[model samples]
Target: MRLSMDLELQDIPGQLLLALQPLKDNKANIISVVHHRERKTPRGTIPVRFVVEMDRSKLDAVKSQLVSLGVTVVRAGEVRFIEDVAVVLVGHILDSDLGDTINRIDSTGYAEVMDLALTMPGVNEPSSAYLRIRATGKAEIHKALSILRQVGEEKKLLVIEPIEDEAA
Candidate 1:
């Protein structure tokens, strides 16, 4: 399963590696790691987020190892973003308040824009944006797409959804 873990570690060198040692020892597949370097928690520890794919049975052992090594496990659970889709919008995306559009989908609490890329040709020209949205499930993904469709109509943008794979 895909699991996300929040950890607090000392600012000393090799702490990050030490925190990851348990995951390595348990044979978890590392997906992503985000280390907050400048932001230290009140406990004088740096916050690090990790996403990995590992068997359920190994999770507890990994946690025990981490705690024994002095790593603080703030949170650990299954990841929610399981369904993902790519979408495109072509129009005055920036002029229409891109942040609000993204917020509309994100405020649903089931979906979020994971990646975004925007391009504008000229000052008065329309712009295009590529959005990678991840949702908790297919139903949520559809809901997010519907919200985007409504936003597109209101903003006069062209929203394009990915074509379904018939074989899948």
Candidate 2:
């Protein structure tokens, strides 16, 4: 099963590798890691988010190993973003409160903006972006798309959803 972990690591050399040792020892294959250098916990440790895959039986052992290594495990749970949808936004995307647009869908608790590619022709020209959104299920995906469309309408941007023929 896929899992995710939020960890607080010591700000020192090899700390990342040290923190990852538990995942390796427990046979969890690393998927992605987002090391937030700019964010720190109250103790001044760095925050690291990891996505991984492993057998359900190994999860507890991995968590225990992580704690033994002095790594603060903020959260550990099964991965939830199982459905993916593609969308496009056209017009002055940057001017239309892009962050708000993304946040509205994410704040719904059913979806999130996973990846994005943006284009800008000039300082005053309209911009566009391709977004990859992930949701908990197909119904949640449609709701997220609906939210995106509403945001687009309010911001005077053009919203383009994925073709219905495309597989989720």
Candidate 3:
């Protein structure tokens, strides 16, 4: 059976490894992991998404083991997150408290920032960033981008939203 779970882990070194150890102990084979270390949830916790393959009978045991390791399983079931969105933020990103902006978008539970890249030309020049976000569905992805745009506007930054393809 294929299972997807969302978990909350303490923001510390090796915490992710520690959380995964329980699954390994239970003989669960990890298919993929979407780990976001830069953003924290509203509860001040890092969220992790795990895709694992295991027998249905072992599902309960896996949950128990994860809980024993102080990991909070946010959601656990068969559904997978299949949507993704990317946006670019331009103009003085660093000076506007980039961390706070990222945290706000991540706090919305439905979406997470999967990657970020920042560029700065000089001390007085503007900084730009490319952010890749992942969400469970199209609606959630749009909501995340809207939140990010709001943040950028408040900080006097320019946001380049994703353009949809005409023939998709």
Candidate 3 lDDT tens digits, 116-135: 99999998899889999887
List pairs with backbone clashes in candidate 2.
none
Better of 1 and 3 by lDDT: 1
Q: What local distance difference test score does each model get?
A: 0.87, 0.84, 0.81
Per-residue lDDT of candidate 1, residues 71-97 (tens digit): 999878786688999999999999899
Sorting all predicted structures by lDDT, with the top scorer first, yields: 1, 2, 3
Candidate 1: 10-residue stretch with minimal lDDT: 135-144
The number of the candidate with the highest lDDT is 1
TM-score of each: 0.54, 0.53, 0.53
lDDT of model 1 at position 108:
65
Give stretches of model 1 more than 4 Å off.
81-88, 91-168
Candidate 3, after superposition: displacement of residue 13 in Å? 47
Q: For all the candidates, what are their Cα RMSDs to the real structure?
A: 12.9, 12.6, 12.2
